[model samples]
Target chain A: MKLLESRGLLTLALAGAFLWSLTGVDWGSPLIHTGGGAAARTFFLALFPPDLSPDFLGVALAATWPTLAYAVAGMTVAVLIGIPLGILASGTVVSSPALRLPAALVSRFSLGGLRAIHELVWAVLFVAAFGLSPLAAVLALGLPYGGILGRIYAELLHDVPPEPLRALRTAGASPMRQFLYGRVPLALPDMISYTFYRFECAIRSAAIMSFVGIQGLGYQIQLSLHDLLFRQVWTLLLFMLLLVVLVDQWSSLVRRKLAA
Target chain B: MKVAAVTAPAATQLAAEGIAKSYPGVQALAPISFTVSPGERVALAGPSGSGKTTLLYLLAGLLQPDSGRLCIEGQDLTAMRPGKELARLVGMVHQQFDLVGSLPVVHNVLAGRLGQWSLASSAMSLIWPRERRLAQEALERLGIADKLNQRTSKLSGGEQQRVAIARLMVQSPRIILADEPVSSLDPALAEEMMRLLVELVEDSGKTLIASLHSPYLIKKYCSRVIGLRRGQVQFDLPAAELTEAVLDRLYDLKAERI
Candidate 1:
């Protein structure tokens, strides 16, 4: 135990592992492809003077609307799926010690299975099954986001101060009443904040859904990249960034209100 | 209009016969026997580890004793289910006065009525806050009606205690159990709260059993005092009979060491 706690020995072991891992790279050969340096330089240079032409701007703005729409639609579904499952997974709402364990285990397993598959993978699977519908993109973002949010919400509900819940219990409140009055109210501010954070993530996820053939900002960016219209790609990237920033700011405002 | 009828708590007797409880390595209570008549105000007083809170929990039906029997209104308390049946018999005011902090004061007060509300109506009350007048009347009785819409967490400590009292009034359980209901208050405020509490219990014809640290407040507010030490009852006496020597013995450190 003392050896494990030693700082010098730990550092030595970490350094040794790093040096051994470095041996796998070939130092004698050129790592970069021919003309790769020039292509990188051009990409970096396009970031400065983004394509601000009226025609290109029109296309970028049009794509931004669909991206925003998809994110909202997806988050609506995520919230719907998240709140109920989160309550079930919390295990605090179930008072019967005999039943709480199995119920919690099942819900925990469900949430884990959901988050284990990434949103991008779900998108591909959904697009394959649904064939290019907007619902596919919404479901893809919603499923994983629901899982992530449910996990967080369950923890929040579980972690509410026990004093209030105990007071409710001895006051003869049922488990569900204790949850609604004690746990949910106390945990609401944090839950709202986390849901807002997840909404921001949903926007990014919705934009990425374009790679699976859904029409949005990511698809436009892909098209510009394929044609090597790097300037237009930068413009499209800015629109995505703007959407994320707006949602983040809006979420922050809502959280402050909730806290108050 | 029916919701606003704050009916007086029912007259109910509480009895404990040779009831004892033990945790992993400590005995929380030992063969304590007592009976509280309806409309009686009793105070359980002792040091920090004197089993007062544990005894109160047992009476509230929050904990079960390992041995002996507890009866409420002549029925077995241990057999009681944790729903409206138990709710009708017991209501508790926490030492911390556990009001839902983020919610409006009205909602926290109204939560006392949840035992009687259906799941759908309770959920809907979050939006519409049904029976607003009853909640307002409870706060008004406690002299905090102006704070009806204020968030519970934002209230002062004294105000929060009043809110807990108001909630109990709305609940109108046959028996009210309080654990240090005035622990966090200043001397004047504590005395004021005790007076108000005693008055409320008397006016409504309800039973009250509170565990308190201060002998003065206990004597001033409660009709009977039950002093405990090391999870055993030391003395059961009337408030007028609580003399200084008896108090010294009750709080004696030398005897406690034994």
Candidate 2:
């Protein structure tokens, strides 16, 4: 009887839901049409021959800066917010038993609340509240990303070997002292690597923020697609792809240096 | 190395009366009374579950006893808040050699003084080490000066243990507590480490209390032995009186069987 309600059954239920969703697709209504499908085909075919015109190439190049700037600025804000919240949520620096529990609970709850709203939703909300400004995009990216970074940082601090921390405590070191000498150095490599990974995600998020009227590669792509310039869309997309690749290489280099 | 003569002190270095600790369901340590004087090497000898570590932790002020009074240099540990004063007075060498793996040997050794430094200084030391010469001197004393800049994780277990000892050396505490500090080492390395610890204590005229698993090591280095069984003191006697018969009884083995 228990076997019928096991993990296998749960998996089967998920598969059933997915299969059911497939039934809602309209298979007969020109799924591949004369307008959209041909445009998509042209977009795919133009991958090899992206717009090489110097003026258009310059526009794509120019758009890349703001995308990079937004990502860097947003991540900086994220890190600034994340580290302190992470320290609090980790409960590593709170030694008094009376305060540690409440501190941990409040910080953890705040992080969860911040991350629960998707970045796009946050952007939309911010757009409504503050109009279409770069500040809105930056805050939208920063809030969710900070929450994620904070949660990861907390877990990393908590997961460090207890022995070293205990040794520091036994030596009459303060909670902050224990964190600085024992926890931070031990958890640093993991924190650095995770932060870089989030930076990559920040880039993608910054591009998507364009839908709310922030100018970036996504805005360029959106405009080109509306104008039926599939080649230009492909060109802007290549720029975004190039940016991602560059960030990946940079992250790898930084991680390698840290490891060394 | 010559054993340092026990000098009569104005006050005991460590005095514990009726010190007891209990976990959720188990009494880890029973009410036991003991006083350790200056310049004495005392070994706590016991089996695995005999509460040696619990006693050490209580003495180190890492865990507060449920009942009893503990004093260091006439200062009440329980009444006073935990701070650098207690750390300045006592040093502990852990069984696991609790050095941070990602840090260099110099940084791990310098951590001994973290309690003494201001918060700003401690943070600043991470970027620019404030006491490099002092750290190097301690490591040099431990004979690992060559490995000063190497990451602690890359060192061998025995080397790491030396690093732990070097950290304690830098601490320069008046009373030293070692919790099975050499239990992880081979017999030869254990003896060398034990000898070095004894020599350091002797030279500084500090109180040394170490929980040792091996009876032979205790008999060789320690002037006195406190035997514990089931969280209570079974015997407290000079090392010369700890005979094979007493050890067998301390271990609770039948005479005929032994």
Model 1 segments beyond 4 Å from truth? Answer: A1-41, A94-99, B1-12, B253-258
Best by lDDT: 2
Give the per-residue lDDT of model 1 (tens digit) for B1-258. 012232445333888999999999999898999888888889888888889999988888888999999988777888877667677788888888977899999888888888788878888898899999998998888889999999888899889988888888888887888888888778988887788778778988888899876778877788888999989999999877887777778788557768
Residue-by-residue lDDT tens digits, candidate 2, B117-161: 898998898889988999899888888899999988899988898
DockQ of 2: 0.55
**What docking tier does model 1 reach?**
medium
Best of the candidates, TM-score = 1
lDDT of 2 at B236: 97
Q: In model 1, what are the clashing residue pairs, if there are any?
A: none
- After superposition of all CA atoms, the RMSD between model 2 and the true structure is 4.3
Off by over 4 Å in 2: A1-43, A95-102, A227-229, B1-11, B252-258
Residue-by-residue lDDT tens digits, candidate 1, A16-114? 999999999998788997899999999989999999999999999999988888889888888887888888899987778998999889888888888
User: In candidate 1, how many Å is residue A2 off?
Assistant: 13
